[model samples]
Target: MPLFRAEHGGAKARPRRRRTRNMEWVGSCGKTDENGHVLSLTRLCLLSLANNMKDMWAKDYADNYLDHYSFRYIMGPFTLLPGELVEELTWLLCTRKQMSRAALHLMLVPQLRGLSLESCPSLVTATLCAHIAARCRGLRSLDLSGGQQLPSKVLCETLCCLPALRSLSLAGTPCDRGVIKAIAQRCPLLRHLDISRCHLLSPAALLPLGAPLPPLPLISLLALDIGFGEQEGDPAAAAAYLLLSLPGLERVAMEGLGQACCLIQQRQFNRSDGFTDREGVPRLVELWRDWRHRQGTDTCRTMREAAAREEEEEERTLSDGFGSDSEEEARRDGGPNCSQNQTEDRKRGGDLSDDGCLVLQLKDVKGISCDFLDSLSLACPNISSISVHVDDFENTRGESQGSLLATGLQAWSAQLRSLSMYHPGPLVNLLPALQVACSSLVSLTLEGVKIGPHTPLLEVIKACPGLRDLLISAEPPTTPWEAEDEEDQRAEQNLPRLANLCSLTLNFSYEHSQMKPVMSCMSLEKVLKCLLAGSPLLEKLSLVSLPCPLNGILQEVLDLLHLHQYFFADSTNSPLMPLGRVQRVNLLRTDVTMMTVRSLMQRSKRLKYVDVSYCWRISQVEWMHCERSTEVQVVWL
Candidate 1:
């Protein structure tokens, strides 16, 4: 009976034995053995099982496989010792793989230094928080971006427990002032924090005024992103308050459109173009500039007296036992805390130059008056990049505002390299500023600015000699151009200013065009030729919202006259051949055909990425059937 049983079970027994033999074993000697492997608890097997585990969703197959009883025993003798457990688990599950709360719980080993739980929906739960607190006690960096399911209270509580945490990201989390205050009090060692999109957070939570409550423990925070959120308090006041409090803050990003809406709603403030009672906001900005500048200037006797008053107030707080009593005296005499002593020394020496921040990105300032811009530019002299939205000259009904905006820009003339502006109205008055002020400007973006037939885009390009990147988006001219006169005008127009341009984007809105494809295509080719002639080093060209379809007629016209070769050819054999180095062409939101795209791809050897997105003529079937021309990546989504 035993012999018969062995014969029947041989089929399964043989494979099981072979599988065990194939498993690589790491014994106590720290050497791998395949053959002579003992099934003792001391030995571990580096399991290399199924290859199909990659197809599974959420849970990483390797992590799941490692979680198996036999595999866990092999890789780690994860013993519960008395001292802290150290594990280098960074990037252990960072491959766009989602891990469940249970799986995360299993992986949470004590003494984890870094952990990134980005995009994990189940990351913030009672059980998970308990696991993190108990196991990940020594974690230094924690990233919880896109975890919207995480409750603010739970998040604050979890973060408060991790005292050693240095970097934290609560981006997209529904956190408020309470959470911010908790972080300030609990996470004193935090060096970097991202609270972007936390709409409920009040600015006062970060910089409480009236009397400094023993000074915030978040003095170590170097970089902050408080961008894109609806403020519960006045943002301008909050910004000033923050600058006065956090002296060590180096980089700040406060780009949001909410403030603009509020400003536009207040029509009473729009009295006159001239600086008057109507210009109270700009005056406030100027006052803020003075107040901030006075923080470190000792030469000014009046400012010194104010500083003396503040110091005395702090001393009074110490006498009331609210401050660090012994440390307060030591700080006053300049004993320990070298950073604090240096701050005090700078205060006494009237040195404000070192107190300026490095980068300040402020967006959606269209509702903000030019005076505010002026004060910002003068106040933050050390800033290298400034992004602000200014009221258009057309909407404001005067050139003075545009001139004022330009004048404000001159404050950072030497330091400024990149300038981005969104002008909802006409930009005619603002052109003079670009022409003379921003000489060191390397990149310029002008969006939503109307350009009539008389608009001198070429002149704007000419103003910045060092300008390498230029983006201009505007509605197409309402008055249709006379086809007969356009050719004559093209012959006289010169674009010598675009010689240094490397990237050019000319986006037009088709909402106002009255011309047919035949006329529009000709006009497009003419404009392209003109721009290409001027930009010899141009590498990226995006002609978004084309007025006509790139179909058979356009292809035939180019083919018959051999214009395709001149426009797309690598060599400068033809006089009309543009010597420009264009590598990518984006024709998104147009009516481009497969044949036209194929021809363009075949001719331009340097063209690598061709985006014909939303082009209805190029069907999905046709795109799939089309041959890959010149290794070009044609995107037709």
Candidate 2:
């Protein structure tokens, strides 16, 4: 009989006691506290031993530890940790200078899914890639960007092994045409590929993908970044071929395509072949044009056949006495005719070959003309993000091309959600068009643009109600008085409240020299206060090279936080308080004091990153105090 008896109470029952295992509690405590400390200490000891192994005693000790104790005892606790933690530990170990061949072999486990050895010149060798290919067969993402030492042959062979790879970034690697062909032939399941800055890769490297008879097409590829790569042949023809062939591509970064597009357009308009004898440009252009025409013809033929079949089906239905007389009369009177529908479908399908492309990156591209932009718009009707350098358009050709560039931007403004422009060559003429057409813009970046009375930064903010991320790198005005006057005028105007704004960066650093005086309409305390007050949801605030002192700005933010708390004390509806969501504050090269840093840390509860590099006022002692007070990472150098 048990004390805890059944509900019927048939008999007396004994009470059930909870079981407490001392071993489980001891194991949890050891793994949580002692194991981490012991492992870190052992890793430090091992690194020291590896460095001093030239001595007789150190060599003996290291050999003994590696042979008898390292894997059996030191690595036993890692099994209890999660796979992600293990992978991160492996990456850290591999990046260290003390990492040897034996250590690398130990880290390459079977459960590894993602590995990034980016810019690790010492670790990214052909043998390392071979070892990864052999061990990490289940890997999904691999980033070996800037691995200049990795040989192309080994890379190709390594890619052939990892068929499960979904993302692969080989930027700045010396991959050639053969490697590109191998990737297209083997890795069909790849979704994102980045081969940017691969100077050895020619334009012909992508031609194999568009070939009629291929191993297979990269049908699952969604994003391709081939930007900044120096090509041997005609890049425009290759890009056109790719767009026509791969209708599944959603984002493409062709940073140097502006010059190539202009070249193609110029050649066509002038009926000249400037590059006919060089690099087989004429042959590739002809091939692309022919393929495009064939695609349109095939689409039209297919649509007509489908329409004919539909008409036949309707006539058969009428003959079977299932249709009314009114229906017959309407069909005869050309109401919703099948031919019209077919024609419309054919026109739409023929015009847009790469309608799936949503993002295009053309940074540092020059010579963008109107016809090329129109053609691009027709091909990719849904481009939402674009990064371009406007100075190229103004400085390379003339002012007319800049106007053409502005017109192209206007054409795309209706669909653009993110726009980034560098250098202020003709932004004065471009801003008005943007104000009217860019109502749907969610992110805008203007770098090296002069923001004065002419630019009117407030007007741009007001125009885009949905803007969430804004970055302005304004060059300093010629005189300090002008900047002060502009700031005063701006502070007088009613600041627009940006409820949806999450990130804001205002950089007033002169491009050539950092010691120069800060000059901008945004280099004042009142203007910053108004901006911060308007952005209630701001998470990241970066003020680089500003003239205004950090204490005043931080004080304003602290006051706002206190005011928000007081007002919302009794209200339970608001989940986020003002300035509470500020996670990152970058004050690079600005005049920030240690007191301001401490104040910001005390007020902003969720602040995680504080960058005070090049800040002259904060002493080491004060920095140590701020660092020891909280877990927030303070970057100072």
Candidate 3:
């Protein structure tokens, strides 16, 4: 396992998995006994184990490992105990490995949020939660999912300590109905709460859900979820009118939302929103719930699951339309009138950023004029991370594309160490702009962006030597040569080659010129001499569109090249070189055979990532007949 260290003063730690036992013991102790006989055993025996476990704590090495951006976590016995748990917890909340950790946390946290850990099986629940609650002061979101060992009292004390808790997940938590109501009242600031498997929750347990508070009144709650039995009590009524009293909620997700669909559909609001009255309210709660139940059922498992939605849902209304909640005093606050949809958008936008880092999340702002973006740039100067999605979204017609503010980007590139942009044109256009505008653009990603003519992109890349992620579409150069004259030729010659291409993918769609083997024996002999170069730091490569060679071409070339032992009979094709520090290369639609792969393995000891999708020839061959590529990841799709 390899740990990748990023410049953000963070690193990743890899997990070492042992398969011998359900609980494999790994300690930093070495003991030798000739007869393998113990004289005596007592609490002293376990103490030795503990001592050995404690000895494995090489804090310096662990700290170094924690400094990386990505790594696989391998648990050691010493690091899994109660005290050791604290150390592991501290290593993450306080160290590097943050990029990879953020990636993993983002993936799991959504599912883990609002879960109760009274059912966690791997550790002593009460002791673990108590310890974590005491130390993890930064735990704003908790997952007490399936926490089988955490008793109600442990949860109560821990819940009180977590004043900053914004989300609580009690799915499968063993707390009784009484405990649920008490905790809800205690933690009124909670925005999201899940009581999913409280096969024990009742309306009485939820009455405290709307208990009033004093002075500022703690009315910041927003979301609540609960699972319904085939025929449970009125948990639905408790959530509906109960939330109305607080007067401040934007979104909610719950199971068995079919019944609540009736309430929202019958309620009155507005037609401009396609949500007459409260008709659209049900859509918010069931969207996530629908995704959860539809997982693996020919439906989307993710919420922003736009990729899988085949069609839009129909609309219906219950109550009359057009009015504010004058019933609540806070609703009477004076403000210039805005469209209800704009108000809803503002409410949703204000949902999470209070404690989290400042963000520039501009998505689907249809026709946002240059002046609008410029104004925004002036407002959020503290933003360090940005996610911009301008989909077919156009600026004001006739406005120069240059008018949209790049000030925010320029500011971010200077202060930010992490940048992720998702736009086909802006990403490519901004590359050179960023290089010229900011001195430090270390960690940046340009995903799914169409970079026109490879030359400009190459120019930008060369300019930004500090770039760590240059992910771009593999489209071939639209204009391979710009040399109308000698001056142009000289400039083209100065451009970088495929050698420095750290990660590459040859566009499968573009015009692909065929790679014919050397015509003569002499030329065939020279293929081995052409050493691979310029692939330093190259971990992944895809050679797309190279069709399988004809049988005669394959055999003749193999023998002509003197590849009697399949492709690498000579010393030239030995597997000892990893170009540009590359660890792996994937062959996509290539004509190369297993023999050629064998030559690759024989030549490069660092070989990894060899996968073939939709290839039938390799599927039929026996392992003995086929030469194996000693690699880390091999997938035959």
Candidate 4:
């Protein structure tokens, strides 16, 4: 364990002594003179020296004793010494361990602003709370999470005394409604409150214990995180009460209150009948019945049919070795022509002028409508990136007409540089809309979404020319065998030129267990070489949990540059791998060997970090072969 050093920045703690009339009063504290200014200095010294510093001192005196006379005579001479010349004092040791009543009294000071006594089970007595409330009057933040449980009265008194607190964290503590009411009544300036694991407190106990008076204003909280307890009782009511109490709150994070969040937003946005129900119960049952009457059990059948038609059209255009009319129509609608317009776009330098970004993470997408995005765009016009994460993508949908693709295209497309959607529901209109609108996109991450599952992933790559980072954590389509004597036509197709690509992460980890093993159908060797052909500036690559032999993966990548030279012999001047700037490679949970790792390191001089963890067959001795290479750090399982 590391030793705790209370000295700030390796400097010894000095007894601050000012040269004034107060100095003499502080210095002459223990001297037993005829003026009665001293109280038996020799006897006090003998008593202090002989005793083991037991808890005999008054709590008030012990907590504020540093401002008194005893410590003045003990360490006042060290105040004249320079910082570098001061010797280390072994008697004064301070740590975060549980503080006895005497210890806490001695440590309390007016200058202290922050205190973290987390998980100190020994310091849970009511006396400690009373001492802190009396002495540490200037504290602004306190973290007593996971500490010893306190009685409701002591907890109430402790919180009520700290009216100047700006932040208070009491997670995993025992408290009742009375203590919470005391805090609400006293700490009117409190901005953040976290009562996450207070299991004894229910929604009924959290109903804004104090109302705003004429002179005193209501507390304007910036954030409140209250969830994850055994007795949440009625989360919707609690959330509603918090919102009604703190109307100006900016963020509210609740772990087990997703349904409540959705309900709150739905009521706030869709106020047709003012969302009035008899017992505050929602109209979800009525809405479900209405939806079932409108649409049959096959809810997603329309979406599937639309996607199948689009896929057949895309495949027909690819098979004929020509572009479709829809592709030209998309270009006319503002799509960037990857092969022809990239040179001019490169000259212009793709950089977003705005720096602001908006992030939204949702557990349910039932209440998110296109009007919501429109309102957000109007409110925050300079938002440069919009990231969306949905918990259950396959079933998430809006109860409105405009689809998710329409929102992406019509709202802030010219300013967006990064678009990340995890577990998307459907993509029949997404690619076409993106190609027509978000041309300046620099980073795209689509995890657990099927893109070109019937066509090819190369088409999706070619649609965006300015992409710098691409992470596709989804499986592609298996090449279809047309005839017994023929092969899949897509096996030999070339990839689009993405000259600005820098980082790529393709994780097919779910395929090993979810789908049948069919590595031969992917034609991965040809596909990989095609994908890496124009991305010469690539720096980081992660092929995590791929169920394939990793023996020739690096060799195939290294040979791609030479193949590019052969295929495009017209130019013939581009350098080998052009940038050759690959610095990190993560092949975690793959079948990679040490020999393959060494070969990759030998090829890329700038390779710095490689994670080949969980390749159990590789020997420890083989790990030593690359240990001497200073540029690379081999991560092991």
Candidate 5:
């Protein structure tokens, strides 16, 4: 039954046997099937050819291939290749920079539905756009995000041509009002649009689309990110208008709208009747009122339409001999029932509880008062993530308004999942509020919060038991008189077990010499051990700018790793296990040594990335040895 018999006779037989062994070895190298092997070979050959050929030669070769393939496919009965395959091939060429303008024109097939020339900045030209417009008519999604060189006119014209585009990202592009207008006018079916960082395009440009008019163009849009773009106009008003207009919008990112908060604060103070006193404030107030009225009107209209449809359906059911006498009587006597329905509809319309927007990003927007936040939450009650920067907690009367801010936070705390606050001022007044309000938080990031003797960081962490990610950048104490009595008292207490914590970043900045004495009182080493022991799921541990003895902590981690390995080697399970899941260790500017680093690498098999940049203790020879010895990525700069 054997197809071939092995023979060990002479040199010729030896050579044949070697060839057979080599063939077997090659076949055992990979587990891919025949088609996968063919595809891999094709890709490798194409990449090799592209790498060897010059730009012009590559373009010529691409043109020739497209010509031959299109001619044969159009003339013969052979089915064309799948669109995804063609798109992948194009993406490969683009990523390698082998896709020239001429090649791009030749490769714009009619079957292509999604194209991302994000990496090919040189090919994002007017002529190329014209080619795409002419050939790729069925393209649904396009990402020209980093095409800052593309002119607004050309972009507008291109977008106008592609009316069928559903998703488009022009982030970091020099898009202007005309281009946005073109999108509203032409691309009516757009569901996702990201124009973030388009500095030339102001928020005023979006007003027309969100205008209180019949047949809103971008009504079907689900996500819109215009963050860090415009700062000249009333961004808050524009944001509110968009939220009110777009009923289906789920995410809105409007970072760096600090000017809007400033304008709102100014308007709040200048509420006099004189025209000179209240120039722009009344307009914004009226706009708010109009938005509220419009929301109520829309809700009432929807309810009325539903009631009318129900009445019609009931009449039809009676005609079809499927309705009872009571239903027929209720339909005929519609005065009291109609009155009750109208009252219920009115009550529902009056309630400002919008559940449309789920994510709202307002990073670095200062002067956000409690009233503004309360009103915003009233309009968007289902917001889950928000980023804000509280510059000063004082009101216009020079009084601390911490309670007011807390009120605003409480309004939306029920649904808040992620909260990032950058408070340059002291958080003594706000920490208590956050402890109570943010118990439901899953991710908490606090930057620029001064950590003093009274600031209980542990208590805040304990409040949010479900936190999966926590980042705390603590500033040094402002006064040297503030002792570490509070921290010392809590040194013996154990941190609450964070069962879900996965990432933690603790940055304690000590710029002055006086703060060094204060830092000694805070038992950071004990705190670190407690946190590590609690967070068994911790994968990323970043200790930046900490003036503590990090080497001891590293040794503890190494010992834990040894214990974990010992238990595994013995094939037994222990009740207390090590942090065996840690994958990323960032000890930037820490005092950890090479011994700890080497032992860590040898013990933790799952360790992937280690950053020891600016670590003075790590010398050149040791850094090089560690980098060469381990497969783990080691960074030493």
Candidate 6:
């Protein structure tokens, strides 16, 4: 039996020292000293020592004690009492110019005005601008953010350098735009300014910056997030448009943008009768009956037709994708290009900019709407990689719409090659995303979600022929909600055929046994006929549990592993029967290890590493009997 331990990095305990003091008249610690001999202050340093030091202090005083005391030795910023003592100690650490290591730390303790130090834990001086504002009076373009406190004097000092100040950021500092405008009026060259999360200001603060000056400078700003907390009083929907209207402004992030996207949907989509824009689709479908009773023939037929059309659409897309009239309505909305991206668009209400770099996330977004591309417009033209979260919460009543919303995010920046999503329903959007430069699109991650049977998971893998890394959660439908649709099953079955796939993980799965197996799987020709399709291009496979063992009925288990290494390693059109290294295999308490598990391990010559815990009830010795017999390591824990 092997021991499993939670790895921890810590300093070893130090030995305790006796706490002693002497007045030279001492009989006991509580006894008074005779002759009234007073204790020497210098001696107190040696006598007033720590007890039980072994518990907290480690042995090597400098190596362990001082090392562990990083930030721990000095009480934090709050503990420093305001006095000359602080300035004296700070000077002691700071004046040691020879000790370059201590200079930055010495400066960090001060809450002085006009100072800044971003993420760096240590800095010799505050940011260039803040330092000058504190020490030099003639300078513009100040940046004093993230570090020591910002007093009004320092803020006022920096603001004095206006018109020449083209770039200024007072982020996380305590200064308002009123003070900012007082400076802006004097400085006309202001180009870039970021005052995000400044609680004391409002949009009206921009008035001074907006006032025109000669040279008619077109100062473009990257972003502006200045405002009060969550209720930063809603900007006119035209605010962003108006800000961009400024000649030089290209990008702006005013609030928690992701949350703002949701809020925008809530506000514009909210109807007075306790209904939302998306909820209207189903309401419209229901209205068919009302219209029929009211004898509104044309309207009733259209509504009836939408209900009929919706029935044929996939459930996963219902919540997020087009309803029966989705296509027709979009067409009327001037979207004649639905055909250009029908496979990718899951939900409506998204528009791609002419440059395809920007996307306009539109109103009434219920799920991951095509509207997601709306935010793509916010990114710089050069960005090619991104991480996105489409769903923050589950909407069980609108699963179809949720999926459509998630899948509709296919509209992407031309440069996109890697994408990650967390908590979105129907991860199938990966299919449409793959269409944008298939072979070049390399890395992808899907967290806290599942791809439905209707989603072309297999088709996506096949299309991304050169894919190197992939992470996905496969939770196959557990119950048969409707009659089994063969085309849906075919799409799912094709997933495990990605011969070029390198890394893979099925975080978890709820897929039923009824789904057909992969198309390339040969041995299970008869058995897999019932359970055929799944992911195949996996160098790293992590499955919490497998309902079926790789060797038992999932016949492609060994063969797929064999094919993957051979195909990728040889880089040949012809199949190489003998494969190479299985770098890593981690299986946690899976059911597929009963029969062929031993044989599979014994045969995989390329199998260099493995972790099989609570699997097959097989012993380490039994596993060692397999092909990787030359060397073996096992940890039961």
Best by TM-score: 2
| Candidate 5 lDDT, 304-334, residue by residue in tens | 6777788999989988999998998878775
Q: TM-score for each prediction?
A: 0.57, 0.71, 0.38, 0.45, 0.68, 0.37
Mind giving the per-residue lDDT tens digits that candidate 3 earns over 437-503? 3345554454445433232444554655554444444333333232234664446435443333355
Q: Candidate 4: misplaced stretches above 4 Å?
A: 1-382, 389-402, 424-429, 451-456, 475-494, 497-500, 511-517, 520-527, 530-533, 547-553, 559-579, 589-593, 614-621, 628-631
Residue 250 in model 2: shift from native, Å? 2.8
Better of 1 and 3 by lDDT: 1
Q: After superposition, how far is residue 550 of candidate 3 from its true place, in Å?
A: 18
The TM-score of candidate 3 is: 0.38
lDDT of each residue in 1-637, candidate 4, tens digit only: 1112133355655656533222122333544432244544433443342243344433444555534433211223222432221111101211313245444444444445556565454565666676567655666777777654578788888888788887777777786678677877887777666666676776545544323431123332211234333343354444444443343344344332333434443443233113224224334334323333323223235444655576677667767878767775763454333323434433544211121121222211211223244444432345455444443322345422224444534666676676665554334434554564447788887766643334345556767788999887865434432211225445445456678888988776443343223343334444455556567888888876554455565666666644655666665464647326678888876666787788677656677788876665466777766687555888876
TM-score: model 6 vs. ground truth: 0.37
Global local distance difference test of model 6: 0.42
Error of 4 at 15 (Å): 11
Q: Residue 391: error of model 1 in Å?
A: 1.7
Residue pairs clashing, model 5: none
TM-score of 1: 0.57
Question: In model 2, where is the ten-residue run with the lowest total lDDT?
Answer: 26-35
Backbone clash count for every predicted candidate, in the order shown: 2, 5, 58, 2, 0, 40
Model 1 per-residue lDDT at 618: 75
Clash pairs (backbone) in predicted model 1: 44-74, 298-350
The C-alpha RMSD of each candidate to the native structure, in angstroms, is 15.2, 12.0, 21.0, 21.8, 12.2, 24.2
lDDT of 3 at 305: 43
- TM-score, cand. 4 vs. native: 0.45
Please, what is the whole-model Cα lDDT of each candidate in the order they appear? 0.53, 0.61, 0.40, 0.52, 0.62, 0.42
Error of model 3, residue 154, in angstroms = 18
Error of 6 at 234 (Å): 11
